[model samples]
Each structure stands twice: as C-alpha cells, then as structure tokens.
Target: MKIAIHQMNSGIDPAVNRAAMDIAIRSASNQGAHFYFAPEMSLLLDRNRERGRIHIQHESTNRHIAALCDTAREAHIWVHVGSVPVLSEDGSGRFANRTLLIDPAGQIVARYDKMHLFDVDLATGESWRESNAYAGGTHPVLAQSPLGPLGLTICYDMRFPDLYSRLAKAGARAFAMPAAFTVPTGKAHWHVLLRARAIESAAFVIAAAQSGGHEDGRETYGHSLVIDPWGEILLDMGDGEGLGFVEINLSRVDEVRAQVPVHLNRRVIPPLD
Candidate 1:
C-alpha cells in the first residue's frame, strides 16, 4: 500500500498546522496514496499551558480537527492523525493526547489516547511533565485499515513493548508510533527503539515525527521512519519537514512471522515468587 507521511515542524497555531495538513492530504491523494500519516500534536505544539489552553477544545467543537476530517473526505483518502491535544471527557480539566483515524469517507473510525505520558528531566536540561497537562489512556487501541489491522500508539507509548505485544497478539500487523521527540532522547534512542519494536512484534512500524524547532522554543528530532517486520528501514525522512511517500507490502508481515514465530513462542512470565 502507498502511504504518505508528513514530517512537520508544527507551531503554536492550530489553523496554520491544519493548513499544512490540508495541502499534504490533497497532495497525497493526488499521488495515489491509500493513507496519509501525520505526526503527534499535528494541530498544535505549544508548551505554554496557559497560552495553549485557548486552542485546546473538546473534540466535538475543535474546528481544526473538523477541518482535517473534511479535507480527508474531500481527498477520499484515509488519514492517520498521529495525535492532537483535546479536552478529555473526564472533566479533570486536563487534555488527552489523542490519535484519530479517519476513513476515506471522512468518518472517524478509531481514536487512541496516548497511554504513556512523557515526564522526564533530561540531561540536556530540558524537562517535560506531560502528565501535568494530559491524562494517560488506559487501554490499547487496534483499528482496521486497508493495510490490515493497525495498532495505534503515540510517542512515549513506543517505549512500552507490552502494549505493542498485546496489539500484535490481538492481530495487528502494523503499528503507528507518532512522536514529537526531544532532540537529546531522539538522538540517543529513536531509531534503535523503533527497530526493536518492529523486530519483536514482527510488524510494520510507521513513525511520522515532528522535526526541527517549533514555535514553543523546543526542538524535535525529525527522523521519521518506516520499518518493515524484518527491521529494515524503507524510508527515512531525515530532519526535514515535508511529505514523503512509500509503498509497504502487507505480505511481508506473514513472511517474517512464518520465519521467526515469536508470537507463537511467546509465554507469559510470572512475577518473582
């Protein structure tokens, strides 16, 4: 299947980001891509909670998201919106880093809230407390796509293999790991971790990432990658912001699984007795 990945350097403005996505979606559809993938926080990437709160709205009322859905419908292409920050239904006043999968008909088919929040104090003197502003989701999300069943995850959730394993075992042959990674950690762990996830799960890993510096004065590692079940890199958009297209073979999932059979061999390990 041909898929388009958008590597973005999103800013604090949701409208601006939506415009970028609109153009990319049309371009991808024109190029005959079956799906268009975008990075996490594709709508807005503001660190200033006070300043960003105004743009963050309930999904029902978020104009930017609605616009993207309309664009997806017009383009007649499936869209994997890596993620967006939206008001949670829990009434906790915190947002959810949510991923929305829009079908070719422009209807939302699946939604996955990021399960793991990034709350780290990096050695680079950059500190992040995602849990402070966003509530983590409790369940794994697996959605059906033209490419097959896809496991949905965002950013920090990629660090937790159990989530991937659960989805893979539940019949997911592809994974979407959208991220806006800090430069330091991204440099150190990005490629290796993604490759590991693909190899272990024996599934395709499509990671659309935020790249370069942002309006919030933060820099992101932009090496968006598409890895095969054999841990081979198919396409790597290195630190550039734009659209990239690649064709993925669904048969490769079966080919790799037949050879290694990790799913068949997997056994639950009990905690220390």
Candidate 2:
C-alpha cells in the first residue's frame, strides 16, 4: 500500500492549518497514495501557556473530524488526522489529545487518546507539564486496518517500548507514532528511537511529525519517516515541511517474522522467591 505522511507547521489558527493539510492531502492523492497521515497538533498550536488552560466545546465536536472524514471520502483513502485537542467530558477545564481514524468511505473507524503525557524540563530552559493542561488517557488503542492490525500511540508514547511490545503481542502489524516533537529532543533521539521500535517489534513504523516553527515560537522536529519490518527506512522527509510517502508491502511482515521468529523465542523464567 502507498502511504503519505505530512509534516506540517501548525499554528494557533485552525483554518490555516486545515488549509495546509488540504493542500498536502490533495497532492498526495494526486500521486495515488492509498492512505495519508498528518502530524500531531494538526488543528491548533497554542504556545501560550495561559491560552492552553481554556477548554472550548466546539473544539471537541465532530465538525472538524467530519471535515477530515469528508476529505478521505472524496479522495477514497484512509486518513489519520494525528492529534487534536478536545474538551474533556466532565465539564472540567481539561482537554484530551486525541487521534481520529477515517476510513475510505469517510466514516470514523477508531479514536485513540494519547496515553503518554510529555512532562519534562528541557535543557534549553523550556519546561512542559502536559498533565497540567491535558487529561491523560488510560487505555491502549489498536485499530483494524486494510493492511492489518495497527497499534495507535502519540508523541511521548514512542519512548515506551513496552507499549509497542504489548501491541505486537496482541497481533499488531503496524504502529503509528504521531508527534509534535520538540526540536531539542527530536534532533537527538527521534530517528534512533523510531527505528529501534520498528526493529524490536518487527513491525512497520509510520511516524508523521510536526516541522518548523509554530505560532508559539517553538520549533519541532520535522523528519517524517516510514520504516519497514527489517528496520530499513522507506521514506525520510529530512528537516523541513512537506509530504513524505512510500509504497510498503504488507506481506513483508510474515517474511521478516519467519526469518527471525523472535516472537516464538520467549522463555518464561521463575521470579525470585
């Protein structure tokens, strides 16, 4: 299947971001891509810590999601909208970073809330506590795709190998890690971590990333990549804003698994007594 990954520089305005995404998707569709993916924070990027505290109802409604679904239907392709901030249910001033999966017919098939929160102090004197502004998701999500079973995760979840391991054990053949990774950490760990996850799980890894500077003046790592089961990079977008795509053979999953057969090499040992 041919898949396209978009690297976008989103800002505080949803209209601008949506327009940019539309152009990218149209271009990919014109190129005959069967599936397309956008990076995290695809809708809006509010760097103002104060502005982040406000939770809006319209943001969580299905309107924006419907628009992406319409795009998918018109293009007749599977579309992953990365992550968008939605209002939390309890009427509290909290939000959820959620991912929407639109099928070829423009129907939402699955939704995955980001399970990991990015809370850290950067070396450049920038600190972020995601838990303060967004509610954390408790469950792991896996969706059925035309290619096979796909594991869903966002930004910080990429750092947790166990999550991917569990998904692999549950029969996930592909993994999606959509991220708006910080420039500092992304430059150091992005490719290595993504490649490691693909190698360890022996699954295809599709990473759609945020690129360039945002409205908040924060820079993001923009190298979107697709790695095959054998850990070979199929497509790399480099350090800029654009669309990256490649044709992936889903059958390669079984081929690679037969070679190593690591999944069957598990040895259970007794714990300390």
Candidate number with greatest TM-score: 1
Candidate 2 TM-score, C-alpha based: 0.94
Candidate RMSDs in Å, in order, are: 0.7, 1.8
Candidate of highest lDDT = 1
Per residue, candidate 2 scores C-alpha lDDT tens digits across 7-56 of 88888877678888877877888899988899888987786757644423
Per-prediction tally of clashes: 0, 0
The alpha-carbon deviation from the true structure for residue 8 of candidate 1, after best TM-score superposition, in angstroms, is 0.4
Global lDDT scores for all candidate models: 0.95, 0.85
Measured on C-alpha atoms, candidate 2 has an lDDT of 0.85
Tens digit of per-residue lDDT, candidate 1, span 159-183: 9998998999899999999999999
Model 1 Cα shift for residue 57 (angstroms): 0.4
TM-score of 1: 0.99
Q: Deviation in angstroms for 18 in model 2?
A: 0.9
